[model samples]
Target: MPIISLPVIWIILIDIIAWTFFHLLISVICLKLSSTFFLRESYWFKIFWWEKSGKLWQKLFRVKRWKGLILDGTIFLKKGYDKKGLHGTKISDLKTFAAETKRAELTHWLSILPAPLFFLWNPLWAGWAMILYALLFNLPIIVVQRYNRGRITTITSPNK
Candidate 1:
């Protein structure tokens, strides 16, 4: 049960405002940080033993088929890096692109952290819905980032 109660309309409004606020806040913060901050593949962004360099997602989720459907959110940001398509094949460009995938993935992961805050005012079901919304909204982008990062970094890696 919610610790506090609001009418349905108020709850809906709060959900919209809260989600938008958190999304933009996280995006802007991530954008301002140096791309080099994400340039190295952190543990969270690396291909796990289970990931098979992201091929696991392709096998289990058919990522290649639906990856094109993901809309790049950078268009909404005036200065954010556009990751929709690679701008060049140079090693420098590839490195930046790889870093950007990490950045994008981290942004979406951070975006989901606020979902539980909705439970403070929303009923049990709606609060759960918020968590679901967060996952549904972010997971596709997250998966695409992981998959692409692996491919990009593999090419960029001298050891590969």
Candidate 2:
């Protein structure tokens, strides 16, 4: 019987241990920040749409990879331009939209680092974390969407 090299075994062991710890630590931190801090104040955020794109895709395609792609996609969209702006041709309307964008820009800054950090460390774990986070977060959104489904959404359309 041949004995394995100590360094090789040690390296493999370290990789597994590090990977597990990284997953756990990142999950806990994101959960705390997302659930307790940011989403706590706004049930809409906690329950409905924080990273919903992943789940949507997962449902659309039977493929497992869609899970991460959906989550990452939603995060990217949420961090993108505010959806409340009007597409008026006039300069004044554009200026007004620019001045008072409804979507929170600060959320982008807050959620930015955690996703990328986790992703860089391990895409697999990060994707898992994102999926879990999105599901947990969507509980509130579902309620809101249902509650307000037929209700008239007030849209302050800019006068062209």
Candidate 3:
């Protein structure tokens, strides 16, 4: 007999699917709540900011090219995706949209937090695989959010 049975494999698959669904669902909920409760300058967001992450992402991933592809391929970061269905042309609107993007990026990071807990129920390889999946899905978005927010901030700054 194999180390893991077919029924066990089915259970693992179900768990992975459920985990992905809950992760996305909770992320959306948090994103919605954050729009009302959090500000662009919120301390929680500031704490996570690493000047190095942005540099690393740019150097390692060439996020600008990926961002362009993503923007073209998906509704993400596109105009009219906002709740008000407005695009950020004006400085104030751009600032608001930047803040919203930061909130969303933070939510994605938070959503990944539970991945390691899968180890409690799953084999080591399976648990790590889920964690990798979570990171792969969210890291690019996080990098893009930071990159765009930086540009928006620079544009909106009084000194600019």
Candidate 4:
């Protein structure tokens, strides 16, 4: 049996330590800085920031272009809300802003690390993985919002 070289062993140790530190460091930074990302409306919504169940989902199937997904989704959803008689800037608009802002903040925060980390994980994956994971994991909440808003529009519309 062949033994690993001293330099190779040192490199492995360094990589492991660095990787753990970087991962935890990013999570902490994101948590601390998240308050500035959302609205002041309610405490219930803040749970979205700290939820852990979505972590695995984000890691498994994060979108390659999350920024675009966010931008387009916000636009698409906002249009639906608008045509349904919802105030564009009050409800849907604010939600869109919060989602996009949070997405960008998380992506930018993760990008603060050195080049190796970004390249090693694929920049697209690293940047939008959280946002994608949030979408996938939060689909139920999204659907509820859409359904509730749609119902409100229906009940309030005069044409009905």
Candidate 5:
């Protein structure tokens, strides 16, 4: 049912190349945007009632135990804040980290948008595999971003 039905080897090569291209392109585009743009949590970044102010990730994903294992996007492009860990203790520093989390989350979310296009060359099952690949590659990072941002909010809030 694919539009092109490329051979399996070619399809695998193309999938690798395409994902690299899309991820880097999305990262570069996001880098060009002002960090200030991410300062405010948009609708998607808001902690859902079910998220329990992001503690859900700790309880379910044990984010603190392994989130540092995630690669820092700054290593790929030197233009943004380093997310390897908290770099400072000042309120301003925390705010900057929070903003960068939004940027990271948005980049990962955008990176997943092209999954369906793999169907042009891959079979039905492969295309769904691509979708799974996208989520598996990006969702944990997104979870870390949201979880860290929620923790940041707790620190920066006055009454909490």
Candidate 6:
């Protein structure tokens, strides 16, 4: 018997789409809530521990050149979206927003990990593929957020 029939393939595709949609919803909700609940620097937003991985992603995607240009186009990071005036352009507001934004980006990527669990009914390859797809889709976003946050931190630092 085939591992994945036509119907099964369609189902798998739908499942992937559903997971992607769910991930987006959760990410947005978390992003919004982070502003309210985690408005200040927290352990979750620490970059010291993840700096190596962030740098790896930055190098892999050359995020320095683009620096979250695609994400900036979205309303999430748009000016005045956070109601801090001028869309968080001020140094202090920008720093806080950057921290929350970084947390949101990480949450978005991490939420996709469970996607492969939905594919457990399918063959191993299907589950693995789902995992790979999740990583591929979110890795760039993570990299961009990390790169942008680093720059923002530098700008906001008092010594800088």
Cα displacement (angstroms), candidate 1, residue 117, comes to 0.2
Model 4 segments beyond 4 Å from truth? 1-6, 38-112, 116-160
How many pairs of residues collide in each model?
0, 7, 0, 0, 0, 2
Instruction: State the lDDT of candidate 6 residue by residue for 18-114, as single tens digits.
Output: 7867776666666556454555666666556456635755667677676524544246534223312225578867766676566656665677767
Tell me the whole-model lDDT of each prediction, alpha carbons only.
Answer: 0.88, 0.35, 0.63, 0.39, 0.89, 0.61
Alpha-carbon TM-score of each model against the true structure: 0.95, 0.27, 0.72, 0.31, 0.93, 0.69
lDDT of 4 at 70: 33
Tens-digit per-residue lDDT, 74-158, candidate 5: 9878778898878799998998988899999999999999999998999999999999999999999999998998888888867
Which residue pairs collide in model 5, if any? none
Q: Candidate 4, TM-score vs. the true structure?
A: 0.31
Deviation in angstroms for 70 in model 3?
3.9
Q: Candidate 1 regions off by >4 Å?
A: none
Q: What lDDT score goes with residue 62 in model 4?
A: 48
When sorted by TM-score, best at the front, the candidate numbers are 1, 5, 3, 6, 4, 2
User: Lowest summed-lDDT stretch of 10 residues in model 4?
Assistant: 76-85
Best by TM-score: 1
Tell how far residue 138 is off in model 1, in angstroms: 0.8
In model 2, the Cα lDDT at residue 97 comes to 37
- Name the top lDDT candidate: 5
Residue 75 lDDT in model 1? 70
